[model samples]
Target chain A: MRIGLIGTGNVATILGRKITAAGHEVVQVYGRSAIHAQQLAAELQAAYTTDMDHLDPHADLYIIAVADAAIASVAASLPLQDKLVVHTAGSVSKEVLKVASTRYGIFYPLQSLRKEMEQLPDIPLLIDANTPDDLALLRDLALSLSTQVGVASDEQRLKLHVAAVMVSNFTNHLYTLAERYCQAEGADFSLLHPLIVQVAERLQYMSPQDAQTGPAIRYDTPTIEKHMALLEQHGEMKELYAWFTKSIQKQAASGEL
Target chain B: MRIGLIGTGNVATILGRKITAAGHEVVQVYGRSAIHAQQLAAELQAAYTTDMDHLDPHADLYIIAVADAAIASVAASLPLQDKLVVHTAGSVSKEVLKVASTRYGIFYPLQSLRKEMEQLPDIPLLIDANTPDDLALLRDLALSLSTQVGVASDEQRLKLHVAAVMVSNFTNHLYTLAERYCQAEGADFSLLHPLIVQVAERLQYMSPQDAQTGPAIRYDTPTIEKHMALLEQHGEMKELYAWFTKSIQKQAASGEL
Candidate 1:
């Protein structure tokens, strides 16, 4: 299948490599930067273009792996001639592509991508197209690369984005906090990793509510009070402890904590 | 070894059962309530006691797995009589046991323990003691159950506790937040999980700053504006977006983002 690859960022570069490796031919590569487009296209032996108008729209499919904000405008500017266009953004609405053509959809891969990542999984592809034919085309395209494919609505994708924040962004903050707190105490943060890994794994079998441990959940008032004393310097952490304790107590009352 | 376990709470119950399974006898079970004590003692085939006088200093060792507030008083009151005594708390200073006995330490199992979670891997155990022999005894005891064991300072243990909060407690709260937001939008939260796991695995290889994705990290102003607009109702989320963006920007600037 011939592919019109959009953008030359990490996701675009990674997917470009993956798609080409899967025996699909990338006919054109577009990027906001001319040099980046040329660099990526050169690697894939494809045409490179900086201008949106230069996009051929002649390939079997057009993949938009650009920044989410640029998607709608880029789609609007592209002379697709009613070709199928897909944008890969978790929180962006599929309707963003509708302005360009009704034969558009979302082709989101549920993974963090980067230029240096050596091993990329045949990612779980979440596809949603406007027409049944387009859906079949996207699904068939996704099936060639990934075994896991599902149709997700905008609402479902947004919900997933929120969950992603919890486990990913917010969870990473915990590691940072641990590192900071350890540094403050002149301790090695690495010592706590085993504990971190175990607590994380426990969540596999148990719900977060049931797997919860520590001073907050137990209502260990003295220790809670002690931690609060130490956290006085970090107002955010102090507020977090207070709010979390109250939240857990409320959840406990509801048979959730 | 004959063991006297104080506080028949969930931790005590779990430890009692596991120790019993290890073929060691829990000679005495102490609880704040006589009924709870008797019930736990019956389960472990041990004698039950509510009074401190029955805390036989004759037992090979005493494990105090009680609440943080009660720990100081309970240990103070127990007829430790220089008997080996250790408290199973991550936050509390092991010095709390010094008043009760000359031979004491801490035996903190570095994993979240739920009531029904009967089996656990050899999660790294953190041990500390007031004397060499006590440390050896605790070390041998921990080694008997798990190969992963180490000694950490009280300050380090507290940092671990704080990290535990960020990962387990705070992460769980984020889940709750996502659920609330998704529910408000009629979104399916499950779709976000693979992304969450991806971010998590990414963190194992890269620092949080490097692993950071999404509009906030990408500096995609339009997408950020859209997400900000989406978060109009949640004032707290708005603040989170702004603060986290600022923080990530600084880290990204310094860390080659």
Candidate 2:
């Protein structure tokens, strides 16, 4: 399928290259920034355009990979008739693409993407459309890029997005805080890397609740008090530590596992 | 070196197998439960003992791998003299072992251990001792079991323990909550596995602060509000979402990165 990419940010660049590599022809690249559009288009071997009106109308599918806020305006500005249009934002609704074309859908890649990554990670694509035929077409297109693809309604997608934030964004925030704590205490942060990897790895084989082990779950008050004493100097981390400890204990007590 | 393991929990079972695999002699296994002591001793092909007075005094090192609360009692009961005694509790000080033997230290493995796991994950051993000679001896023993080993003071070890809880225990708790949310919302929790793995894998190449990307960091109020509305039914999750969002924004505003 001939694809027209409608953004040049990290998601756009990574998806553009991936789509091109998947044997789809990325016929045009569009971006508000001229230099980024030109550079990405050159890398993708596609035509470049800064104006939304110049999007290649001849392409079989147009993917709007712009920011979530800009998706509506970009969809409104695209000069396409009945061509299939999709946006890659997780939170945004698929209905926003209806302004760009008669047939619209979502092609959300549910993974963090960076343009500089040498190897592409496995991206689970969540897709939805206004019609069954359009959904089928989008699924076919999605399968070309990822093996892990699923059809989700707007409500389900939003829920998945919330879960994604908890697992990825919030989890990484804890890591950031822990690294900061390690730095402040003059301990080597890398010492915890193996533990980090093991915890994530164990989730594949066992439930996270089963994999949980620490003073928090055991309710080891002595250890907890010691840690609390150590964290006294760090205000934000101390608060978060207390919050997470309480949360874990509550969950354990509720027998939610 | 000859080793005696004084516990029959997950940590003791895994460490006993690992130390035996590392070509050291596990001379004896001791526990309050005779059945558990026998089972672990049978697995390691070592002698089993339920009586504290029956511990192998000839062993080079006596590793107390019991629970945190029982470490002091176990150490006080151990019948050893002038032998290296170490407890495997992260937050416990090496001084607790002073009651067990003239030589005392800590041999804390800074990773979660599960006896049922088919493959032994890399365990980073944190060792500390009362003397430089004992420290060197413990380091050699730790190096035999794991490639990643370090010497940490009691305060430093406790700090690392806190960080480990954040990265492993708390992170897994987040995953547990996310999986529960997915189940409640009728979304496949396994779909987020790739994202979880990638987020952890990227930590090796970049700092979590540098790798952060999400609505919280972007301070995208629209998405945040949408998520908050969806989380209304989940009281605990909603509160956590609000706290983490505020925390991430505060971190970003502080320009600590």
Candidate 2 ranges with C-alpha deviation above 4 Å: none
Q: lDDT tens digits, residues A30-69, model 2? A: 8888999999999999999987766677988888988788
Against the native chain B, each candidate's TM-score is 0.86, 0.97
Which consecutive 10 residues in model 2 chain A have the weakest lDDT in total? A50-59
lDDT, model 1, position A83: 80
* CAPRI-style docking class of model 1 based on DockQ: acceptable
State, as a TM-score between 0 and 1, how close model 1 is to the true structure. 0.83
C-alpha lDDT of residue B224 in model 2: 94
lDDT of 1 at A102: 60
